[model samples]
Target: MTNISPIRVTGLSGNFDMEGIIEASMTRDKEKVDKAKQDQQIVKWKQEIYRDIIKETKDIYDKYFERYSKNNIVSKNSYTSLSIKSSDESIVVAKGSAGTNKINYQFAVSQMAEPAKLTIRLNASTPIVQQFPPNASGASSLTIGDVNIPISEQDTTSSIVSKINSLCEDKDIRASYSEMTGELIISRKKTGSSSKLDLKIDGNDNLAQQVANDNGISFTTDGEGKKVATVLGKNLDADITDENGRVIHINKESNSFTIDNVDYNVNSKGNAKLTSITDTEEATKNMKAFVEDYNKLMDKVYGLIVTKKSKDYPPLTDTQKEDMTTDEIEKWEKKAKEGILRNDDELRAFVEDIQSMLFGDVKDIETLRKIGISEAKDYNKKGQISFNEDVFSKAIVEDSDKVYKILAGYSSNSDEKGVFEKLKDIIYEYAGSSDSKFTKKAGIEKSASANANIYSKQIAEQEKNINRLIEKMNDKEKRLYSKYSALEALLNQYSSQMSYFSQGN
Candidate 1:
């Protein structure tokens, strides 16, 4: 039996040992980095899911409150129509009663019917005090076209008129000399509502006085002008009248009112009692019109909630996807129904009584089933509820207040948890740390210091792993070096013996 002596292990080189330690440290660092990345990804996913739930829930809540539950069922059309004709010229007619009043007048000229021409001339001989260009307040001497005419206190009308006619003889702005009063009467050749024939003055310079003296012509100011009226702290046109008698037409021009043989002065801010009569037929018509509006709204709500399939139908098209989802539709219907259902028992009872009064019978769920508002099985054996819109509309008309109460009560119970509060709780449950085994193992902390402690532990764990790897690598390297050193020594010893043997030989 050959006895093998154990070889003495030698120390490892610094380069060999240090390289192994570095490689082991690098491996452990890479693992920690990967784990951190995965942890971050998990957190991100949790946040995203939470956000999506909150957003979808909020959208459903807003649609329920803003679109279906709001009160907006009032009619606004209550009026009567009237027609009038006139054959006179420049005659104003006021023809309408306090209720359902209207005014229609016309002006006719026989000369306008034929192709006859009329001429009116304007002559400006003496300068008139006219407002300067741009600013109406500045006073300046009148200049017709390009010639400047001067006005004196003693200037005669004829001389001034002659000067004006000579300067503007064939201009479109014609000036004709009047021999009756030795004056120049200025008028436009064309006469229309918009024709500029009135004299323009500088502020309160009294252009009438200037024209009277300069042309020796007498003129009178038109008494009719724009009139203003006010009612309920709102300004309105003085001539406007409510033909239907639904709205009170308060005339601002009528400031004096006789009350019990005593006169009272009313101003813009004051209120006056209108003793005008109303049309009962028109009022009823207006109320009936509101019924139509209410019906339309109810139909819209029903359509959104109810789902139906066509017989022998094809697959849903892309366009169908644009419609509301089943979940959304269900939520909307529930909200609508709730809004119509009043929470207050008294109000609910009152609405029910009103319905009873209108329909002569209370339509409960059983009654609705008898009237074709019950569940029915389709060809696929799936159950679905069908609504009777006509019956539902009659029910609504009979008891609108009941319907209103139901709609106003939707998703508004005070006892239920608020959406925002629920969302916050969900977030807290998902993100918060608790004193549980799973949380502790996952390195979740209750306090800020605990978080810091966890981080410190992770760091220490990483360092310990690195150190263990270094120790393992160092042990392997030491064994490798020791074996190689021993082999090298044995080989050298054999070489020396061979040299001695050769020398001896």
Candidate 2:
């Protein structure tokens, strides 16, 4: 049999290295996924920390506002007081006068107090003049002596009264309608010693003339001789002036006054003078209420942070774990112990003093001892403290003011940061620089140069590892493939030799 050289083993090296390439790719992919997961965890922790800080700060602020509102100390300015008086000379005149011989007379009256100007309008359709008999259509008409006077359809007694009221009502004037007596009385809304109202009427009509002719109804020139207005057995002062300059000034304490020879009495026994006593009492009550509410809040916050459950308690679910991780839960606990509960010696001393004053109880007791507050048994494992809420609440009620002083003064000292300020500092540290200066320079030449040195070292190490892995895999693949190929080639050569021999035979 003719011998044939074994087929030259060419292009087999690359095929042997395939396993190394696949292993390298898998390692790189795993590293990327691990980095992503780590980044996500860091972000979640950061959010939790920030949220806790905000919750603590809000709790403190809310407590402060609640106390302030309860105190009733609003921040405004302006107020006013008012008094009123009427004429004593107010009289209802009968419709007809006796022995009226067409007498011409004038009636002029002035109010003791300045009349507040007012406008009066007609009340429905009451006729201005009273008629003896009804007309054919059930309408009544006025009859002037020796003349038939047709009353205007729109004319009414209410309208006439309204018009007269409008003319007389001024800044100081007040109007009241007397339905029982059908009298429209005008008075001063705010009466002083010098206040008044003036009314005048001149007429030739028999009825109007007779009413004006009566000396009691008309004001006279002589101040002492003029008619005196009286109401409720009190004399009202009244002075008539042609120039309308008359006014009645009511004395501060006096409740009686006169207007145009009329007497009027005012009742002012129930009026209360402006005093600060009510305000002071209200403020005191508010402060007391604030103390109570503040105490309750303090108890709640302390309980939430420091309370602990025994290990026998059920294990927390995933959701419970997430909730516990929140910043608010963590922050409240931190602040209760470190912020408000810090400087226990000073706070307890103050609390003791307040308790002594308010409850007459003198006991040398530290807050922790009084309230059963203690260092958590598993503080290291759980990151929490412990306190008895019932004990804490009792302590708060016993000395509310002391508690308020402690909480309000918690962040007052700028030298040492408050709980909120400390939390802010923590947030700033984690969030990194708020400025964009570093971000802008990230890929610059100087940055790039620095990064190049570091990256170069890292790249060298990574490449070395990658290469080693690749080489190792490649060698193993090559050995295995080579063995397989050699066996196959040998089998083929043997088969060819056997066939050649058979053919020769």
TM-scores of all predicted structures: 0.24, 0.23
Model 1 TM-score, 2 decimals: 0.24
Models, CA RMSD each: 22.1, 24.1
**Which parts of model 2 have CA positions greater than 4 angstroms off?**
1-26, 29-45, 48-399, 406-505
The residue-level lDDT of candidate 1 at 91 comes to 26
lDDT of each: 0.35, 0.35
For candidate 1, lDDT tens digit of each residue in 257-351?
A: 33222222332332223322222333234324433442333233333224342333322223343696978655543443332212323223322
Location of the lowest summed lDDT over 10 successive residues in candidate 1: 226-235
**Superposition error at 350 for model 1 (Å):** 33
> Global CA lDDT of candidate 1, please?
0.35
User: What is residue 375's positional error in candidate 1, in angstroms?
Assistant: 13
Which candidate number would show the highest TM-score if scored against the true structure?
A: 1
